[model samples]
Target chain A: MRKILDKLGFTNTNTERKTVTFGDASVVSAPGGRGWTWLSVGFFIILWCLASIFEWINPIFWPPIGAVWEQFVFIFTEGYRNFTLLEHIGLSLYRVLMGFFIGCLVGIPLGFALALSRVMNRLFDPIVEFFRPMPPLALIPLVILWLGIGESAKIFLLFLAAVWIMALATRSGALATKISKIHAAYTLNANKKQILFRVILPNALPEIFTGMRVCMGVCWGTVVAAELVAAEAGVGMMIMVASKFLSTDIVVLGIILIGVVAYAIDVVMRYLEAKLIPWRGKS
Target chain B: MSGLSVRDVSMIYNLPNGEDVEALKHLSFELEPGELLTVLGPSGCGKTTLLNILAGFLAPSSGKIDFDGKEVLSPDPQRGMVFQQGALFEWLSVEQNVGFGPKMMGRKPNEIKAIVDKWLSIVGLADFGKKAIYELSGGMQQRVALARCLANEPDLILMDEPLGALDALTREKMQGLILKLWKETGKTIALITHSVEEALILGNRVFIMAPRPGRLIKEYSLPFAEQGLEKNTREIKKQPDFIEVREEILTMIWDMEEEIMGRQEGNNA
Candidate 1:
């Protein structure tokens, strides 16, 4: 057990440690952390391949890696249903972006109002608080009933997923404006409008960006789920259709696509955040 | 007539439990134009409250402040402030931050740019005009704050321990810069600080206050700041006169703090 622990890099080195304290252990010894990420991913793929080849989990349920790859190529070439795979991806992206943008447009201003004014907060606080905790997926039945199973219902669900998060993020952002900054602005001869626009708005951007990133993630998850419940076309619907026919390879392919797309969106959002708000955590 | 005057200022904060805390009591003082007044006190001495009232950020429950022959009801551009830290806008570039005041007052863009350039050079941050505020060091950030305030050409400057966040060496350097600016601009400055050495080095007039129903207890008119302009502050500190005064004020503050601590311990027992 001691040898195993040593091999696992958990050796009892405390006895041999120097008496003097050093700087942060994590920063001092984050050796090859990025390498570990790649190593874990490589190990998982190898294990999956080995399990499939050895028939550890039945092929029908597990679907070999090659089979999933073949399904991906088939869909990429022949398309899913009447639409191309790209088209399905594009359609989902469109819904998410449209819903997300609209949500931001409306919610950001609402959040500013709620943060800046007592009356607005009192009027909207209960409604926002009530709906904020509710999952957008839980609203599917009502949304479908009201807007039907068309694109509007799906977009509405995505919008719901985004709006509350945006509002909350923006409100906190505005509220987080330092008292000194406002006082500084006022003493600099800035009027109320100038203070709001120049000081408060810029101060709130970092928080608003954080909200956008979180809201995007929630909306991405919600869009897929909404599609699964009612849509005729989407990555989620494609997976649903594939599973009905026991085409586990296509189902696996679809799931992979969803994960990949979601990850790609997040990476893009992070890049944009870095470009726009370089002083975010530094300040 | 052209400087700041505080007449009978008092602040009482009501606690949630229905008790009232007298933050500042019957504080009255006058700050003459071009005079540098440094206020020193132990914690809870209401020095901060007094500074806030002077800046017009907080309204005293009673009493009034008059600046330049006008009743000071709110924060005006003519009275600028420098907080200890984090008052500089991180999102703005150094140039933009310095130019903020003039821009807000609807000055022409060329005039604003000129003001920013002049002040940045004066603060020795001329090369850092386009640099983001967060990219600067703590000391550099304070320089930006000073430049920003000066660009407004405020008749008076209020500072709340502006060098408190800096290292000892940096604090000394900033103290020199502040003295130079005070002599050059000749603007009335009221600075609140906890450092006895600092108050002595910076202020032509020093006001020391006591805690618990906070009010002014003593005032000293000193010549160190004027001497500091021509000689090193370190050399001045070594002088017999400076050392004697420093020791006296240190003991004064130390006794007040000990008394407060003793009272708290007695209450607990």
Candidate 2:
């Protein structure tokens, strides 16, 4: 195994190995158990234990860590045998991704339009400003009225939440393009369309990516809100059902799942940003 | 039928609060073919305004910019400009930035490649073709900007203090390259600079302007027109008239400073 690991380029000759119980042997490092992550987990466990034994507080309101884990296992196995946690998570992810992509399709060009043309700015600025300030969740009732309680209404709500952020970011980014660069482009005899595509759009990509991140966060938050009203099979629906039954462990488990998923999406987006904007970070 | 002609050009800025500021007043100059004309002045002297008009980037409120007896209305590849900040596209590789002009003009890939390669060699950035703009030093970026402009094969090149951002050493190096390019290409060049020495060093004819409603004060022609100062800067410094001309230009600028200060004081009173 050690030889195979070395051949596969996993060898770390600098480290010393130590054998431990539970039939596990591992390399020992001085920094082990000294990181903030370990301390944070230890504190979380202590808090969970203390909160569980208080007894003065209702158990339904604050479940113990073990209880939450147990509920998570139950939901994965017997409790949700018909429809697993993964199924709910998959549905939620689909909704967010679909809405987010739709927002990008509409938002990026609209933002460029706002930057490039005064006529478009005048025509759309008032409507955009009015809608931009209102919360996307607030439009849920109107959306449902217009499109009914189907996937369309929920998707529309998510798109509405994400689009404004993307548009505003793109417009600002386009406007921030250096005049000198534009003049240089002009002197090169670049046509209007060429200048817009080659110079303006690529320069705005970094800012556009920033807007996409904010839009994603908003999309995630609004997905829960959209599901809260009438979702049949989503994480938000699971939490709402657990709330009514006073199942604190299930509620905690759902909340943890949502947080973890959101964190993972955020990490992925950050990685994408680093890859796409390699030039921006270098300077 | 001059290479470039500023035919009694004037510019007026209508301020947001309904006030009017006259930036340029009857600015007229003519560039003979293959002449390097440098304009020198204090800040707000419309040095840039004059260059912009000639480059067709801006329209004068009065008078006209004419090129080869035709009225210049808009920017064209025939009159290329190199800006002070390099103005390189950060996203493009060095070759792409240099090749941008030809590509946009719909030149064939082979033709564009030839032009890009030729200018890149002249600027001494031949090996940095695939590198990103941000990867280059300030001096290298400026050289790329030069290469980008030159690749278009412009009849008249307008530069707005193109080497102002460089350190003294880099600026001197760039000055050398500019003189070499001027000699080899023989392109009609109009460069705007605040540095009197820079104006004196590069220009065949130097036009010194007065600040605030900028108008040309005087034009001086250098005696050593064919001599390359980049190579013989020390010998030029040793010349009898070089120090005298430098001091004369310096006094002209100091007088403008006093006039501006006096105006400011009167406004306070």
Candidate 3:
């Protein structure tokens, strides 16, 4: 029965197993693990197909996978609301990148100031602590009120999302520098400027990269949500418009696209981090 | 006056609860140029505090430190320090780390490279200069630290349990390298260690401290360091005189630890 089950693919027969013993006591067999990510995704798609075929959910609420695919193809070829799908993605990415870059530009210096100088920390720490906890989405109404419902408003919202996180991350990074490293540098005849630029800055980089990754994620999320409330062209606007017209297929497609794009951005950021800061956790 | 001198140096830490902790008290010592001095004591004996003060990372509550006829006020290029571990800058490669002091001093790139190369080879890390600090083992990292400190050509070097993190085999090997560097460079060195044998093997003068006020209790002038420079350190460890001194120091520290333990228990009672 076991052999038959293995032949039927009910068991992972190809996996290699080895028993590892610790000291003179317990031994446990562990299999060489491989990810089954795509398999689980395929299974979910099949389940969705079955649900649609059997009318397990209302078709309007949960459209057939075929309908979503057709919407994707149509948007890819014929365009949507006078802009190509790529154009919409590009416009959204442009806003996120601009806000993220500008936020880091302002926030990283502020973080360094806060960390290095007691006066700066005392002055700005309360303001940062105040805004860091408040969600960027909560500021949408205020941002629109100040800047109006345009690119500036959306970009401003994203900036707000990224700035505080980057600032906090940079501050912690600078503060986390080991005292011995500073002492060693000082004893080696490093002046204050050299210590700040060489020792402190480099020491703070791994933490700053971590902050950047977090900032990117928050900015991506904020851009989508901001577009849902305002903006003429974006993935979130596209989804909102489709939902208003009850075109669930386009809505589903937009949601999936958002998830895939966010995942891709995170993966790229992780790859960059590994390449730039190879000694991150090793020390 | 020509080398390094500590006159009645004392460090008192004021606790938040309005109490005073005397970390070091009336610590007086002198290390001449080319002398290797190793400090040995149990925990809370202010050995680290003394090293820190000598490195100019700390100012004693009262007392004075004079090096090379100058009062030591702050950390200077002339006084280099080596921590036990995690003091290295991981962001820089071994070469960059070794060249840091010179680079900071605005030396030419070529000059810095030459200094780095010379020291890297001295510490036996010549080939590993380009490697990131994290890629190296514990012993290799300490070697880089040593090279980095030596590359600066400091007048004095302060080491705080530099080999404490290494395994027994690596520690022994590093001890030999340290002795070689000391002999060749002729720089005054003050090293702190927990091991009595290490103190005996490394120091021309082994300064022993006692806690409960953290004062110097004993000082021994040993010939083992000079002898080890010529003979094997391991073989020197097996010598009759070396064993005798080791046992004596061990008993001294053991008694101090027991006394501290008794005092703590009495305080509780």
Candidate 4:
């Protein structure tokens, strides 16, 4: 143990106590960024190629990875401009953003109100809980009947997807704040508004951020579902159109596109999480 | 007139199954201005329960607690609490956490900054203002908690085993810090602790309590005074009288713990 500690550069006199350093695992930290990606992607390609050669399945049901790759390249270049994919993607992004914003606008305050006030929690609890478990996809027929097949229908569905998750997250966040902290604030002679904004909001940030991340994922799924219904363009619409003609390559490409886009967005959210909570990974 | 008073306070907590649990049995105590009163007891002796009532987080089943002759119906800024776990917001940097009370009080930016700076320096976190609460060690986090509460400049400071979670060295360091703070601020303090040594070290007058239906068992006045006593904390430990009082209180708590445990076993049987 002494030899290992010496090799690891450990010493005592309580000198150099101000900062502690530890060994880093560069392979774990930066695995996917370098040559490791080639290995993973290569394995995926081999698996896909073997599965495609099976004689039992329809050719269109499981197209070759090469076919899908060819279509992916075509979609990215000449075919994408003519096929209205860009416009569809833009419309989908806009609808999701609008719905997400509106949901947050309502959910954050309602959550605070629910957690802070017993009366509000009692009154809204039943109604919120009733709607909470129902999948937003299940509400589509009614939504279309009420709002029609235009932007409102899609936005409304996305809002339903985002709002409840946000509200529930906020409520839990608010309630979990330590009473000692509140007492500290009160003793400081802080008023009600101050207690809520300064103490409650700041304490609830990490939870709220977590909720927002979850809600964004839900919104992405909701957008796809929304576009699938009576939609002219969007990633989901692209997939829906491809499915009609049994164009397996387009379907595969569309599915990959959605996965890639969502994954990219998730990466951004993770980056923000890291920046916002620098101490998180240390422990 | 006393700076704070607790007159015949009785707190009863109702269990979810509708059973009544007596937390504080008509407990009453008073503190003069700038006085430091430390309350000590065994676990489950309602030491923290009493602190919570004083902080106005819970209402007593009957009786009232007063600060500056005003009844404490609910929590107010005039009686700030430092919790055992520090309870600093993980999201807020040290500067924001310290400034929280003043900000809530609607102090201007300049005023908030000045108070935060002063308290941060007092707690020896002057350079750590931008550091997030989670970035701090348990000791540093508690220091930030102390700074945050002190920045409110409350007439009374209520602490519930504020250094309980810290290691021995940290706890001792914190005991010293509390004495230093009491000397500099001259704020009335009511601290609840399980450690008899801690009670002896920090309090001008130590209030010892018995277990279960937790009632005040004894109050001991120190031979040494609290004012201008920062340098004397370590020296006071060496005082024969201090050790005697600590031993006496320890024996009382040990007896109460045995009695409580026996009673609990009887209920189980």
Provide the lDDT at B120 for model 4: 91
Q: What is the TM-score of chain B in candidate 2?
A: 0.96
Residue-by-residue lDDT tens digits, candidate 4, A20-105: 33543442353233344555877987788887666435768877877888887777665552555567667788888899899999
* lDDT comparison, 2 vs 4, better candidate: 2
Best by lDDT: 3
Using TM-score, rank the candidates from best to worst.
Answer: 3, 1, 2, 4
- The digit string of per-residue lDDT tens for model 3 on B76-142 reads 9999999888999998999999999898888999999999999999999889988999999999999
Model 2 per-residue lDDT at A101: 93
Residue-level error in angstroms, candidate 1, position A96: 1.2
**Alpha-carbon runs more than 4 Å astray in model 1:** A1-33, A50-57
Candidate 3 C-alpha lDDT tens digits along A116-138? 99999999999999999999999
* Superposition error at A66 for model 4 (Å): 5.6
Candidate 2 residue A156 C-alpha distance from true site, Å = 0.4
TM-score of chain B of 1: 0.99
Positional deviation of residue A275's Cα in model 1 after best superposition, in angstroms: 0.6
lDDT of 3: 0.91
Interface RMSD for every prediction, one decimal?
0.7, 1.5, 0.7, 2.9
Give Cα-based local distance difference scores for all models.
0.90, 0.85, 0.91, 0.81
Checking candidate 1 for backbone clashes, the offending pairs are: none
On lDDT, the stronger of 1 and 2 is 1
Candidate scoring better on DockQ of 2 and 3:
3
Q: Measured by TM-score, how close is model 4 to the native structure?
A: 0.86
DockQ for every model comes to 0.83, 0.56, 0.89, 0.49
Give the per-residue lDDT digits (tens) of candidate 2, residues A1-283. 9776545444545444533434434443333333445557779788878877775457777887778888888777764525788888888888998899999999889999999999999988997898888899888889988998787888888889888888888999899888889999999989888889988998898999999988888899899878888777788888888888898888889889999999899999999998888876543
Steric clash pairs (candidate 3)? none
Ranking by lDDT: 3, 1, 2, 4
